[model samples]
Target: MTPVSLWNRSFVLWLVGSAQSRFAAALASIALSFLVLHQTGRAGQMAVTLACALIPNLVMPLAGAWVDRIGLKRPLIGANVVRGLLQLTVGGLALLGQQTGQDVPLWVINGAAFLTGLSSSVASPAAGAALPALVAPADLPRANGMMGSLAETMGLLGTFSGGFLVAAFSPAVAILLDGLSFLLMATLLLGVTLPNRPEGQPTSSSLWQDLRAGLRLMRRSWVLTVMPPLVLLVNAAIGPVLVVTPKLMETLGVGPRGYGLFLAMEGAGMLLIGVLFASLGSRLPLRACTLLGFLLSGVAQACMWLWPTYVPLLAASLVFGLGIGLINTPLGTLLQQGVPAAYLGRVFAVLSAVGAVGMPLTLLLVSPLVDRWPLSLWFGLNAVGLALGGAVWGALMRIEPHIPALAEERSIEQPQPRR
Candidate 1:
């Protein structure tokens, strides 16, 4: 297969649009948090508003099935338009409240958050499922890597800008800007062309049946079945580590500056690895990349457990971020290469829903224990679990030849369209 240029028209349009949308999302997140706290004068209300956003994840499977049945482009475009309108509504309400000398109601904000999230549930899977159509299969790793880097860069920039905008103007202004970003993304997407659904593909099946078929595919594949739990474990570990990092920084007498450095190092590491993947990831074996990621993450966690000092912890954070990039980028490629195009949206949705379900549950379970238990113990346990998880995955691959074979079979059986 001839390698496709990464700068191809469709991909460039998608990439630019995605980057701006991600930036808007990050900005909106910070603005929303500040807005809720300012209006309600309570941190708990902020948490509740955040939870409202998460509530839509419960219906992600349905959203995914719907995307698969209809196709990607329209759903992607519609989601952005809807989210933009929702954000505009919130901003308008906030502006009205300011003029009227009354606070925007907490429930209204929360409701908008829920609706925005629901729109994203559709957008997320549609976007992921659209990539294979926009770029060649061999370019998936690089494509995904570029997207990851864009997200991280935009997120960092957006967070900083959001803080400035909220402070200098108002959260309402930042939120209105976010709404504009979404509308811009939708406009850009209108210029890109996506493939129509393949002729003869079944679409009359009920959503439940489509969802069930997606699930059945997951169950049939060993890699699909086990990978989610492995990812969940990693997510579980990362969340608690974030929650406790502030206390850890305090213990080291490093203050907020050091805490910021710690985060910056992690983001820098992720960004570096993303660049590397974009440049050279196509030559690498997916399984080896994934295993190395897990191992590196485990080692980084162990370093955190062994050396409680500020410098070492920062180094560990960097390594952990690199591991995360390694794990996610290749895994995304593996799925895109292996899954049937017809089912891609649903599969991505199921995986996303799993992450959504796992994160809060893990945080809830681990948060209470943090105050009482030694943090090092938590790190040690995660280190062992992550390392063992990698080894176990390797063992599973050795015994189950179907993993690589499945991908090869899919490539041969249903060749991707040449863009």
Candidate 2:
């Protein structure tokens, strides 16, 4: 008998399309910053543009609820199409203005960014929810791992190439590439046929009720409550690390090369771990991976405090990256297996919203302290917090009864006729 393969056509296509879209996003992220800086040369103006992009995060929960009602395929496709058009519009207008010796209006650029962000807010959750429809329950971890690796690598490429692309060609060109990527991804996704709700499942409900249902799920699950705060705290630490890492590097007599190397190592570690999980993750216990990941991350941070050096810091970066993969991948699998398909979009939206808020808030709080406090202080504090968070998470895992939602694991194994 032939062995079954998880890399079915639908899964492969989804993976490729999603990776293309992510790469485009990464490129756009870099190009957007450059465009703002080059045009205005004012930090305040850049902030306003950034804020415009981020403000749409407030709509994520509503968008998620809407996705649940409408289902995934249409929403995901439409979002890509809309976002592609928005970027194309911005790039075309900018190019036309340049040729005509007239500047594109600031409002146009900012409005386009805001609209794209809004479109993505809907697409992100829909994509997450759609995955299980394409692959078997047992294959989710491997699929997610592959997806994560592709996204990370593409993002790294985008970051690495963004500045060079801007220098070599116009920002308009970079923006155009980003737009084309989205359109191509949409085209690929159009060919995919995903499973729909099984018969007897009620048709779509009201958005408000869907919203409440999603919220109720969160309220009921101890894991859900634990995730948001833990995510927030960990993300918050990134702000101070960004500010302090450079100073620390200088003290070690290394320049941007060291910084870049550290980032490369981290990305490589994440990619390596993702590949391992893709193959071996099925045998691993989710709870064990989660706890170990948390502990590893905490220990990595503490290493910085215990012995801060160039080599040690590099090693810490690798461990930190591995830890992130362990935490995120298993958590994602758990969520996919646990939630009813209808509620998946909304839950992911809430997760994204928490991250959006947490990341920016961390920057706000830590930016001021960078000049006043030593780098060691931040590292020590983050280390302790991560350790405690891990311990708390482990305790919760032991104490909390099996969540009813997660009992749907077997339901995910049931075969559905393709739509």
Which candidate gets the maximum lDDT versus the true structure? 1
lDDT of each: 0.74, 0.72
Which candidate achieves the best TM-score against the true structure? 1
The list of candidate 2 runs beyond 4 A from truth reads 1-5, 37-51, 92-109, 196-205, 239-264, 298-317, 361-388, 405-419
**CA RMSD of each candidate after superposition:** 5.4, 6.2
Runs of candidate 1 exceeding 4 Å displacement:
1-5, 34-47, 92-104, 163-170, 198-200, 236-264, 298-316, 362-392, 401-419
lDDT of 1 by residue, 1-419 (tens): 11277678888898898888767766676567667756654444544565567568768888988888888889988999999999999998887887897888888898998898899899988887888888777788888889888876775567556656666667788788789989999999888877556222344458987787777666667788777676666655565565456456656875434555565566666777778878886787777878888888889999999987888998998898788777878888888888877788888998877767655565556645766677666677778878877887788667654544233223333333221
Give the range of the ten consecutive residues with the poorest summed lDDT in model 1.
405-414
State residue 67's C-alpha deviation in candidate 1, in Å: 1.2
Write down the TM-score of every candidate: 0.79, 0.78
